[model samples]
Target: MCDHHHLRSPAPVGIVDHVSSLSENFAELVETEDYADITFIVDGARFRSHKVILAARSEFFRALLYGGMKESQPGTTEIELQDTPSVAFSALLKYIYTGRMNLVEIQEENLLDILSLSHRFGFVELESSISDYLKAILNIRNVCHIYDLANIYSLTSLCNVCKDYMDRHAQEVLTCDSFLSLSQTSMRDLIARDSFCAPEIEIFRAVSNWAEHNKGQDPTPILEVVRLQLMGMHELLHVVRDTGLVSSDAILDAIRIQTESRDMDLKYRGYQVLEENIATTRLGASVIRGEMKTALLDGDTQNYDLDRGFTRHPIDDNSGHGIVIKLGKPYIINTVKLLLWDKDMRSYSYYIEVSMDDKDYERVIDHTGYLCRSWQKLHFPARVVRYVKVVGTHNTVNRVFHLVSFECFFTTRLFHLDRGLVVPTENVATDKNSALVIEGVSRTRNALINGNTHNYDWDSGYTCHQLGSGAICIQLAQPYVLSTMRLLLWDCDDRSYNFYIEVSTDQQKWVLVVDRRQESCKSWQTFAFDPLPVTFIRIVGTHNTANEVFHCVHFESPADTSVGSLINSVATVSVTSGPPNSPRPAQAQQGPAYPLITVDRGPSLSRSSSSSTSSRSESHQSVATATRVHFPQYYGPPPPPPSAQQQQQPLLPQPPPPQGLPSLHLGHYAGHMLQQQDVPEADRMDIH
Candidate 1:
């Protein structure tokens, strides 16, 4: 209606406005629909929902698809979200809708939050994905925080990943505060994984520098954390020392902690270091020069080569310069004695040195002249030295100098302050009349004899008798606390026998703690007694009449006291008879009085009745009897007669069966025999 240009512009503007309005309406409708409904169909069967829906679903759904959810019960939801963040929901929905996530926008804090939710919901796939993301982003700056998050959620896998990443970049992370924080939070876990070595050195170095700068001020919280972490790495003791940051208190603390942990390697290293620093009372040296000669030596001399620049001299009469040995390690020589040559006596002077180098040598000990003879003995006080050089300055020259050996004994200034109990030396006697009689002996056989002779008897078919009439009185030099006793008994007749054990404080008094007469015993029965405090124990023969002998006796004490307690408590009672279930019954019982007793071999009996009518009639009767026999004495060969060769054999005796009972037999009879029996059937009851 107006100008032509104005009409054309208005038409175009109207078209653009209509298109814009339509596009807005379409987008709104798409947003309102379920995310699943909007699917991208790339192939006929391959369809993905819109990203919004994918991202909005909880991790539980991902876990189900990934095979992480084990149980899929109806009416049970694996995950439930309450007030989930808008961003998380949006991200989930976007993934569902588009099958892609904007990983760049996700921060570690948010990632961890989501990961926790995923783990809780059993979305194993999402949890793994988040873990991978964490690994990629882990750095010196953020590792400490990630470690904390892992610990808080009990995500051991994540924590391990973080530790590995930290260990790999230890040098770079040394100055990082986050690393320190991590060290403080989970030192034990890191130590358990052996992940702290590399980082620990770096941390020590950094802390040392910090300590120097701070001039003894309390270490920063970071340094303290580093120190705590180092405490767990006991093997890093030398590394800490090398860093020059280790304090006396710190070293001691480290030792205490390591000892409590019972880490053998750490404990060994600690001892090595401590020993190296402290002077020992025993002196030791290795030959460093010249050829060493020895007498009565039968091995290849080449195998005994000294350290570099040394050689062994062939066995000769004498007159060779002894190899000079230097002792750099401090030790105390307790005794000095040389191997006996058994040849003519040879005199030699030993030159000792205090310090020596290639350029200079200083003698701390004047030539201590000593005689080289058989059975020569010497003892000197402990000495401290940086070097101990021994040289045979003079000896019988070239006269077949039967040089057997040379040794200088010295004691250390310090010994292990705490000493363990010394094991009592076992002195076994083979004499039958001696206080102790050992039988059926092995290398480890030992026995403690109390004054009472009847207390213990060997059941292994061996006998031990005291040398004198007096009972073998085994007296402890001192009393000890006992915890346990073991006895090995042997049955010879292939029959089991029960025995009694008695304990006593005074040699004259006794108490019976075990009463096992009714139970069948074995050839080798181990009896353990409850721990008790006593000085004397006597094992007397209770059941066996056959000579009961003890093979080996072992006594163990919780604390060192008397050998008597240990030997009495721990012993072996070997029997000559077989184990239980042989030819012997367990116990003896009284039999019933009966006449016309009939014994049936099988388990049951049957009889037939007969009737007659003519001139006479007869009656039939049946009777049975079962009897068990008991033996009072063991039926076995007596111990061999004493002889020189027989004396060497230890006595292991077999215990005898219960005494005062004869073997019983069952019999059955009818008619004539029954009527003539002393006891009538009317007044007798059948017994077996």
Candidate 2:
């Protein structure tokens, strides 16, 4: 009786969540727009909001609601916000009352508006929350669009996010659909960055293609951003002869510089690798067509196919029709180099079949569905064959297959397993090759693999939301024996993080290998894991000392033994940070330092002999490449491959074209992803 008494403890008031229930009720009432004290008229859509709640959530709202304005005294009020859109204010109201939002539910086209309006209304916290949401969803297709909005609004935090996205994905961003419409200023900013990862030719092709795509538009204006002087003589002459993309003046200047290579300041020797071309030799051989017209290759070398005026030539639209190039007595072809029309301007579908007898063909590379225009170096394992067949299948515009040049390059390495690997989500920092290290430069994606240790003051590292807990998954083209894993966190020799390394053969069942939870993180460290065969490795995060956010600049692993023991170099990016939470890890307990290496400049890939703890200038440059990456964890299987002879049709109905950019546009896309489906679902499996 004594135990049962005590008046039921006054009904335990703590059992009721006032704020939580209020939030839920507010959210439920959002759409009905019922009992709303204030109606915000945005782009003709009325958003009903409560005055007290709005004032409490935002200073701007407080000023308007109760700061003696006409809106504050209103009995029936409708605030006309023509400059803003409904998608934005709808989200803003929900967030103001509930302090939360589901970014996925918001249409991406409206994300910018939400962010802009957040800033405009002095919802500093909400604005930042929106920015973080954008950062977490960054991708090649949307990064440029997001940047445009971020730049227009001076969202400093978001600007950093865009720069980082471009740092690691410059090539893709430059060739992407959004890139064609990028303002000249945006394009110029990209070209000027030292973090631009691809060769000069990539830029040239993109610019030329953009000009062609928007035919009435003069692409020459964009040429001002092109640094033709950076191209080597061989590369320059080839571009001029093959593409006709460069002007006469630029070509002449490049020619003069190349002709005087002996006296020029540029040294052909000691040239750093830019991770562009694969490490394959262009086996100097002759190619002839089945019709025996020499297949447009008069000299069997680059730019020898036809004059620039020819533009493109398509193979006869018949199943057995193709361009056959005989490689002497069939040396194993490791790589096939195809210089197509600009990647954005045109896309071709083709089958790369190798035949011992020209009649019987075995498909070696079935690029039957992809639409690519830039230099495509396809890597397959060493296959000994006599005839290399380039068969056209389909194209985006149905134009004739435009072939500038097709060359077969051979190497001991057949597998280009890591070519187009992509991080599954924006939660992780995708890898990069080169990164800008200038002080005060915001963090860019280059930090992910820039071969540079992160500097807190410079923010030269990948950062995630303050409260987010996610994994960084690195998808591999083929399974490799795990060797060494390196992580160079932002800010050298300080800071701590709680994380673990995991592996998955099938992105479904993940295995935990390296567990370093609650351990003081290190700057420039390496850990050698026992050899394990795995297709993907995810670095799972627990926490970081910088309680504000979880960040890392570099995450790398050595290429499989097939790439051979490689060399590494190092660069530094500086950032200023308050004192980290705890004592730094003892130097003796830290892993070995990672020296950055820029691969694929030729077999003679070189690196700085010693790891420097010093800073590097704009002169410092490096690039890296990854292939065959994928994560099917929560995502559906990639689109199916096309049949050999089936006229390739659109995989999915082409989405209605994007609406033109909006002023105060929030590029926060929530619609379906505009992915290329580059790596098919079958190929993404363990190669073993």
Give TM-scores for every candidate, taking all chains together and pairing residue i with residue i: 0.30, 0.35
Please, what are the lDDT tens digits per residue for candidate 1 over residues 240-280?
Answer: 65555546576677666755643212311001111131222
lDDT of 2 by residue, 1-688 (tens): 1232233345455675355556676777776677777788877877777788888878888898899988777585778876777777777778887787777888788887788787788888777777888999998888888888787778888986687678667677777998887766666676665445566777778887777777766666677767676676777777644777666777888667756643223211111112222212343344555433343344233443324411233555455566667655434455677655443334466677876556666676765534344455566655545677777766657746655556565444324353332212111222321111111111242344444442332212443322243344554433344556666544323334666778765456877777767455433344556656555666666665433234455666652223333322222221121123323235412432232322332121122212233442223223344212111011122224335442233332222122211001001112211122322343221111
Using TM-score as the measure, the top candidate is 2
Lowest summed-lDDT stretch of 10 residues in model 2? 660-669
> What is the Cα-based lDDT of residue 13 in candidate 2?
57
Worst 10 residues of 1 by lDDT: 663-672
- The best candidate by lDDT is 2
Query: Which regions of candidate 2 are displaced past 4 Å?
Result: 1-18, 28-35, 65-76, 211-222, 232-251, 259-688
Q: Evaluate model 1: give its lDDT.
A: 0.38
RMSD of 1: 24.0
Give the Cα-based TM-score of candidate 2 against the true structure: 0.35
State the lDDT at 348 in candidate 1. Answer: 41
